[model samples]
Structure formats: C-alpha cells, structure tokens
Target: MELPVRCFVKAVRRCFLSYICLAVFCGCLMGIALIQMIDGSFKMDIFERKQNVTKPRTTTLETPVHISPLRMKELAAKRANKTDLKQKWLNERIERLNKAAQKVQMRREVTARPVEPSDKFHIFYYAWYENVQYDGNWQHWNHEYLKNWRKLDTKVYPTGKHEPPDDIGSNFYPSLGCYSSRDPITIDIHMKQIRDAGVGVLIVSWYPPGLSDGAGRSSDLIFSDLLNAANRHKLKVAPHIEPYNGRNPVNFLTHLKYFVRSYGNHPALYKVKKNGKESTVYYIYDSYRTPASSWKELLSPKGNISIRGSAQDGVFLGLLVDVHHKHEIKRAHFDGFYTYFASNGFSYGSTWKNWKTLSVYAHKNGLLFSPSIGPGYIDTRVRPWNSGNTRHRRRGKYYDVGWRTAISAGADFFSITSFNEWHEGTQIEPAIPKSTNGYTYMDYEPEGPNFYLNLTNWWVNEVLNKTVHF
Candidate 1:
C-alpha cells in the first residue's frame, strides 16, 4: 500500500512542473508583441510630424522615409533667407533707377538748350566693326559684303585680293582705313569729324540686347562710349532701332522700358520739345514689320501699354519705304516719318521729286518730314547682283541736287544717309584716293579729302539760314 502512494505523489509533482514551464513560454511571446506595437506607433507619429512641417516628398510604392524635424526647420530658414536677399536686391535696383531718372530731369531743366528746327541735321551712324580686340576675325568687315567669296558670282572680286585696314570690301575706302568702333581714339575722332561737319545729331544704328547683324557685334556694346564722345562734342544721340528676332508688341514694350531706364539719363540723349513739353525721339527701322494694330497698342493714347502722353512718351518716327507707308505710319499713331535709303529712286519715299509732295502732305497732317540725302550709292561690293541701284557721286552734284530739293520742299529736318558706311559707298567721312593690287577705289579726287566736309558745312549753314515753316 505504501509503495503505490509514493508513485502517485511523484506523478503529481511532474505534472505541476510542466504547467509552470508552459506559463513562462507564453509570457515571453506576449512581451515581444507589445514591444512591436509600441515601436510602430512611434514611427507613425514621426512621419505625421514631418508631413505637417515640410513639403511632401514624392512617393511611390515604396514608403517614404521621414525627415527629422530639426532638418526641416533648417531648410525652411535657408529658403526664407534667400527670398529676403532677392527682394532686397530688386528694391535696390529700382531705387537706383528712380534716382537716375530724377537726376536727368533736374539736369535738363537747369542746362538743356533748345535745338532749332532748321539747325537739325541728323546722320546715320554704324558701330559694327572689329579690330585686334576681336583677334583678326574680320567680323562684319569681311562677311557682310561677301559671305563666301568662292561662291561669289561677280565679275570683279570685292576685296581685290587685299585684306582689311588697307584694301577692304568696298567700292570706296575710308581715310581712317578699316577701323574698330571699340577704339576710344577712333570714337573721339569720329565725333570730332561729325561735329566739324555741322551735324547736330547722330542716329546710331542699334539692335536689341545680345542681338546683332550677321557676324557683327551687338551695337549696344559700344553705345556708352558713343554717348560719352557725343556729349563731349556737343552732339545729340538718337537710337535707330533695328528689327531683331522674335520682336513683337509685348517684347517691344519691354525693350522701350529698358531703353528709357538704361540710357535716357545720359545728357547726350536726343530730345525734342512740342508745346513746352520735352520728349525723346526714337527712329524705328523696319517699323512696318509689326502690324499697325500692334503699334497702336503701345502708341495710341488710350490703348493698353500706351506710352503716349506718359512719362515715357516720345516722338516715334517710322521708316518711309513707300508712299502708302505714310498711311500706315499715321494709322499706327507715329509722330513722324523719315526716308532712310540713300538711293533717290530706290523707293517711293526716296524719290527726289516726291519730297515736296510728301512734305506738303506731312505738314497738312501735322507730321514732320525729314529727308535723307547721300553723296552717292554704290553697294555692288555687298549686293553684286543688284547693280541697278548704284548712283554715281557726279563730283558732289548729286548731293547738291538732293539738298536743294529738300530745301525747296520746305523740309525743317534733314538726315544724312550716313557718316561712315563704307560698305555702301555713302560715307561723308573723308576718303583717301586708294588703289590696291588689282582694284581702284572711288574718292573725292579733284578736291581733297575734306571736300565733302566743306560742302556739308556750307549746306548746313544755308539750311539754318533759310526760313523753315514747321
């Protein structure tokens, strides 16, 4: 009986030990699950906080990792600082522009002299040549006349096998030779020559910023120097705005604003007074490129973006290429019209006989008529196929005829075709008699180099002395 009781006690003890081991294993599993839940909740909180503080990063099927709150704060601070700096810089620029405009107004009020209508003789000026500064690239000098000499179909070679600064690609050669517009001495000499010739204004050829003719440098690159030289010589400067790529009404408005803000402050900038109000004058080359409707947007007094009668208002002269262009100019609300071509019969407006009629029409319409005169026209070197347009100098007879016609028509304003357009053989700047390896250049031979200059002085004095009704 005692042995059986001892066996039962041992069995009961074994069963109780197994139950305790099972309890310990279950407790370990529950603890691991609780820890995992707490970790997941903490990660979710962090992601929520990041989303609230910063811009959400793009995410795909893969979950995004949350950036720390400290890092997000740093990024926000950096962006704020950058924005502040940009705003401050813009403000400073605006302030500077305003100050410049004010100074210009004050100076003009104190010292500006009125230019008489009869004394106004404007000249077409070019600033597109290069020299050693361009490293012998022969920029507009070689390329403008003949893009590829090998492909040229002319009977005569343009340059005559001689390079620039000696024998260039022109029917006539300059006394100063192939010169760079960038040279300070050259600029000074040019200013002196024009002033001595009795020219009152220099209508400088200009293109938009970063734009230029084929192989030519931007005209704006030398504009500051030109203005400085003109100021020193007591000559006024006006922009001959050229048509550029992508030009339209919108961009043109921007360009005008930029022009006013940039060079309008210069003392040499040209201005005209009407009814006791002084305004700048701008010559728009190829103004017909933009439709009259587009121009009305900026020129009409009541149109949007209109500068007319505003602080930026000025006399806008459109190119007179055809008789019908006068109607177009009037429809576009242009202030005046000017003939630019040197060749008298090249265009309807350039015809000498039409000057008096046009001048009469202009006066009736309250528009100014400015006739352009040239000594001659010989662009065979540039346009070999178009020789019909060449007009001989006739030893100054042609020029005298043009001047007489303009004066007889009662023109109050006059513009010379060019001061130094060697490529077109219309330069009034002195030209020396030059001959090269196989070519001969035209010049004011019987007279001296200063013959044209003397003639110009005489004509200018005559024009000023006459009574001009405008």
Candidate 2:
C-alpha cells in the first residue's frame, strides 16, 4: 500500500511539471505575437486578425490548488500589475525603434534633398490688410458681417464691423495682430515665412494703380514694397488680376503692357517660358464672366488683338469655377487653368475627390492642371450663414491629406490657395490662441503655431528628394 501511494505522488509531480513546460511554450509564442503586433504597421493588423482565435488556459482558477478567496484576488492583482509593466516596457522599446528609423531617414534626406524653394510651388498672397499704426486705421480687419440672403430672419447672422487688434473678421486670429500689408518689417517677415516654407512664387492680388477692391485700399500701392521684400528673399512675384471695374481681355492686355513698362525689370517679377517665348505669368480671376471669343481675340496667336509674340505676352492662368470652364479655358486660348476656391467642392474645379478625373482630362487635352490646396476654410465669422463651406482644420491633418492626395493623383505642380487670406480662415500663416470680447478663437492645438509651415517644408522636401514618387 505504501509503494502505491508513493507512485501516485510521483505521477502527480510529473504531470505538474509537464503543464508548466506547456504554459511556458505558449507564453513564448504570445511574446513573439506581441512584438510583431506592437510594430504599428499594416501587417500588425493582419497578423492580429489571423491570431484572434482564443485557446483557453487551464491555469490558476482551473487548477486543483486550494486557496482563500482573498489570496486569489491578491495573486490576480499581482499578475495584472506584471502585465501592465510589461506593456509599458514594450511600448517604450517600440518608440525607441521608430525614432531610430526616423533618424536614419532624416540622414538620407539631408544628403539627397535640397531645401531651397522650387519654382513648381505657387502660393496665393493677399496684401489688402491695414492697421492704425501703419495706415492710420484698420481696413480688411474691420470687415462687416455679410448678410445671409437665404435666411429670411436677418438677425440669424450677426451685423456690424469687427473691432480690430482684439476682435478680427477671421475665426482664427493672426500671430501678427492687426498688421498692415504695407509695413516693410511685416512684409520682410512674410517673405521669410514664404521662403522658409520652400514656396517659389507669390501670386499677389492685383488691381490697377487707382482701382481697388471693396473693404480695402488698392493692392497696387503695395506692389513695389512686396517686390522689394520678395527680391530680398530670392522669391518671385506674379500679379493675380482681381475682378475689378472695366476689366476685359483687350484692356487687361494693355494693363499687362503697363505692368511690363512699370515693374517689368523688377528682379522679383516672375516669368516662365511657354510656347517657346519668355513671358511673365498672370492669373485672371472670374474669367468665366468674359466671353470665350473675347479672350481668344487677345490670346490667340493670329487673333485681331493678339499679344502673342509681343513683349507684353504672358502665360495666363484663368480661374476655373465650374465644370464647363474646362472647355472654355482651352477655347479662350488661355495657357492653363487653376482651381482657386479654397473650399473643396465649393466649385467643380476645387473638389479634391474629382482631381483624378480632372487631371486625366487635362492630360488628354494637353492643358496644365494645377490643383489648388488650402489648409482649411472657415468664413463663418464674416459670412455667418456659410457654415457648410467651413472646413475644419483637424490639427494640421487637413493640410497633410491635401498634400498627399494631390501628389498621389499625379499632380506635378500645385498651388496653395493662400498665404494670408484670413477672412476665409485659409491662411497657413501662424495663428495664436485668443479669447477676447467673450469670443474664444480656435487654434492649431496639439501642434505648434508654425506647424503648417514646417509641414509644407517637409512635403516639399519629400517630393523634391525623389523619395515620394508621384
């Protein structure tokens, strides 16, 4: 009887040892799975799906060992603490590995990529702002609250002009509080910002010397100052013809000659070679309002008022607002077309989702398609009823997607909708946090103020480095 009892005890000991070995083997497998899973790649998700099957462990509670309830709880807590510690350590390890990979990539890019601005990048620039310090009073910053025509109750939208220096027209306040565009110091700072972002040209809003837009003075007065500042930074400047009084193709051609005669020799005046001729580039806003025949008369090489082969000839980019403008631009004999509206899908040409189709069509027709990108759009403060058009900036994610999608859609050249069109809240210029007059302004939270600029520089380098293939 004694020998039998001893044999049973030996058998139990052997069985217990076998279970421990099996559990250790399973734990090793789990550790390997965790390592692969925590790498944070697409493969991790796929691996997780394949290994989702659960194999129950007959340990602890299922074991025949006897223990008080309190003792069991303490053991379970200890086990949980151990798991949490392991997870924390694992995450730290993964983070270190990822940082190391980024360091290697940065080294490679430093050797391969040039940080200088590329001519392919164009930024829409506005110079309509004014302030008391520079101009004796605020201009666009005191923008009036626009009426919402659709709403019968006018009270639905706020009325009156915005008070400057504290309350501005924009939803996001600028870092430069109530700054005047004519300020040389401010202009220099702007040029440096543009250059830092690797932007090559500033497509400035322009009207004739005396002509001006509503709510602000004529931008023409500031052109010389802009040109000087831009030249200092080795940046080019192009005139963006705004829709103003008495603007037609013939008169616009005359204005082109005027610009040539006036600022033609300015070092900052941007010129591009096209159709085997050297000419400055110009953007015609609201071009759809003009008849195609009228433009053809001015742009066609053999037309009655053709500027072709002349000194004032320019590579003109017409604003594309609707789908039919695609054919009109070609018919009008314009050099190219650009989608200007920052609000994506607000116009047929500005829709990001339609860019692939648009690019394909442009390629087939042999026209250059420059898809305009905006960081975000929000004019709700000025146009209170235009909430549908407001595109929230998801802490810089919005701008990132715009860059990625544009490049992925085979866009070789693209334009930013604005550098400082603050009225539309599309400005990539730095913005700061503010709460004034009981209004809390939005900011680029989870990111620094210069995040957009840094991001633009990064994307520009990524493309120019030949690392990210279009």
Candidate 3:
C-alpha cells in the first residue's frame, strides 16, 4: 500500500479509466432500454429469430404517479386571461374606429358651406314633363284620351280632335310646349326663370322610385339634372313628397335615410335652421293618409325611429288643407304647415282671410306657417264640373291680394302654388297666345310674357325687405 508516488499516480489513472468505461456501458444500456420501450420492433425481431422463445416475467411497483390539479387550473386560467385580454383589445379597437368615423362625419357637416338662408321664399315645382318620342309615347299630354278617362272626365270634349302641347288636357298652355324634364334646355330655362323671380327654393314634386302619378311618368331620373341646374343658378331644392303606393313611418324613415345619404352633401339640396340645428326641409303632400300616430313614431322626440338631434334630422312641413289640420299637424309633431291648393276659397287654409288665424296658431305652437299663393286658377278644360272653384286672374290683382294677405299674416315663409302645374291652371310659367285645331289658348294679355315673373320678383323683394319681430 505504501508504494512510490509514480506507481500510486498510475494506479489512480487506471481507476479513472475504468470508471469512464463503466459510465459508457450504463449509457448504452439506457439508450437500448428507451428504444425497446418506444418501439415494439425489438420484441417482434426476437420472436421472429427464435420462434420457441418464452415470455418474460413482469413485476409491479408500489409507488403511484401524482398530478397537481391546482397547477392545471392555474395554467388554464392564464390561457383564459390571455384570450379575454385579446378580445377586450379588439372591442376597444372597434369602438375607437367607430368614434373616429363619427368625428369625421361631424367634421364634414360642420365644414359644409351654408348655402340656404334661414328666411327665403319657396315655390312648388312640377317636373313630370315628358316627350312623346323620347318617352316612347304621349304621356300626361293625352291624359284625357285614355280608357275610362271619358267616364271620369268632367269637361266636354270635341268629337275626334285631340291637340297636344297647345290644346292639351290642361286649361293653360306652356309657351315652351310639352318638353321633357330631362331636357337640359328646359331645366336651364326653368332655373333661370325661378332665379330671376328671386325664388330661393324650389320644392320639387317627388315620388318614391318607380312610382308616379297615374297621368304622368316618373321624374326620379331627372332629379340629379334638376339639382345640377339649381346649383348653377344658386337655387336650393327641397323634396315635395307625394303619396306613394305603400308608405309607412318605418319605410319613410328608410326613405329619409336614403335621401340624406344620396343628396345631403349637395349644395343645391335645401337646408334650414330647425331647433337650433341646420337640417334639410321636406314638404309632405297628403301626409294625412298616414295617421298622426304613425307620423309620431318617426317625428316625436321619444319615437323609435326619431331623427331628432341627428344628422339626418329634417323639418317636415305637412299640407294644411283645412283648419282642423293644424291640430293634427301639431299632434303629429310636424315642423310646419303649407297650403298647396291654388283656389283661394277651396279650403279654410287656402282662403286668404284664415291665414292670419292660422299664422297665430302656428306662432303659439312654435311651428312655421307658409301660405301658398298663385296667379290664377282655371281648369275648365280639364274639370268643367269644378269650374265653380276657379278664381279669375283679374289682370294680376288676384295674385297681388294673396301676396298682401300672406305678408300681413306674418308667414315664416311664402310658397307659390306651382311653377308648372298646368293641369290645375296654377302655373305662373309663361303662356302664349296659341290657336290650333279650333282650340284657342289663353295668354297673359296686355302685359308681356314675363308678367307673373315680374310680379313674383316684386313680391319676393317685398318679403325680403319687410321685417317682423315675431
């Protein structure tokens, strides 16, 4: 045991070499055991090489493997927390995007130029004109010639003579003849005439898409052209909603949305100050067809489809055909009232004497009162049975009387009965002295062709100059 230092060192080296070899042998055994456990190939090869090999004995261990349920729950909770955070981030992002879009829209509305003034005169304009060649056939011009038209006709017709443009169904004949609304020249002429007359707004007769009055064709296609012309002449346009086939509050709300989305940005679309907010104006003709309850569903502040204080909000002016309509309009939450009939004594509201009372009622209820006036009314050629309702022109005195009455009544605005409703003989558009096929057309007479236009300009100036505190 007490040998030399070199011999002891050599023995230590040999012992280390033997330990290394033993470690290598154990590692090789572990690798082989792992391979045998992972793959059944070793046992299969053994069985194939020695078909007489016996099965090995197996032994069981007493120790049992354990897992921590608490640790598993902690891992699941961490994963759920990650998912919730992701979802929360996504929701916040969406909310932020929506808010940004709202801001942009608001900014656009704020930045838009104010083209329409708070106080201005408006006129009811008809755009339901068509040409026989372009429109495929004679339309409203031959309304009296259709089947059952004779039965419904209140006027006497000649045996077999039906003249168009000059001696058509309407009592009044247009100087420009029967022209299409889509005609650029006609639109230009209309815009110039309206502008020259100092009318700030034109409430165009409008129906839902694909719908039109029984006698005329649809004017929806010409709206854009009309707007373009109006813009060029610095005139604003409001929609006069006519009765459609199936119009309800819910559907009307959709129509309003469509109008706003389509033309709200246009400079020519008429907008006015309403309840401290600038909004578009819509004149609803024959709105009583839908009940006040239904209208309240959209017009009232607490309505389900209310546009109050929203960007798409508007001032809806209901037709006031009678005195009782004021109460109905108030109940329906309309913004204003307008008399559409040209005949002065036709209705309570249309009569010149009742305007002051109606205006007083409107003021009490904080509603706008706009009285409609016309030059004259004579539809004998169209409704001979109703000739009693006709009011003679009296050489422009009738129109002057209406203007004076409207001015005295303290109207918030003034509306002309029509610019081109020739059927009712209410059109202030120029009429020519025409004689065709034994039918003689009436003319302005004594005055030039621009008589009514000049009269309108004078009244418009008066309206603009006069100031009322209320």
Give the candidate number with the greatest TM-score. Answer: 2
TM-score of each: 0.70, 0.75, 0.70
Clashes (backbone N, CA, C under 3 Å), per candidate, total: 0, 0, 0
lDDT of 2 at 346: 91
Task: Evaluate model 3: give its lDDT.
Answer: 0.80
Off-target runs (Cα >4 Å) in candidate 2 are 1-114, 151-155
Give the per-residue lDDT digits (tens) of candidate 1, residues 1-470. Answer: 99999999999999999888888888888899999999999999999898878955655557586779998899899999999999999999999899967953443233212333223899999998776554455755663444434455536534333356665767887787777888888899988878877888999998878988756778988898999999998899999998988788789888888888889889999999965788898999999888888898889897788987776789999999988888898888888899988898999989999999999988989888888999889987776656778999887778888888888887868989989887888888888888877778889887767767667766776666663323
lDDT of 2 at 280: 89
**Model 3 segments more than 4 A misplaced:** 1-119, 145-163, 467-470
In the range 1-470, model 2's lDDT, one tens digit per residue, is: 99999999999999999999999999999999988777767777777776654533345756455568999999999999999999999999999999967964553244222479877899999999999998998999999898787756445668999988898899988888889998888999999888988999999999987889877788888899899889999999999999888888768877788889989889889988777766888888899899999999999898899988888888888888888898999998887888888787798888888788878877777777778898999998899888889888876667767877788777746789889999999988988889988999888764657767766777788777757643
lDDT head-to-head 2 vs 3, winner: 2
Name the weakest run of 10 consecutive residues (lDDT summed) in model 3.
Answer: 109-118
Model 3 clash number: 0
Candidate 3 at residue 346, lDDT?
94
lDDT of 1 at 211: 88
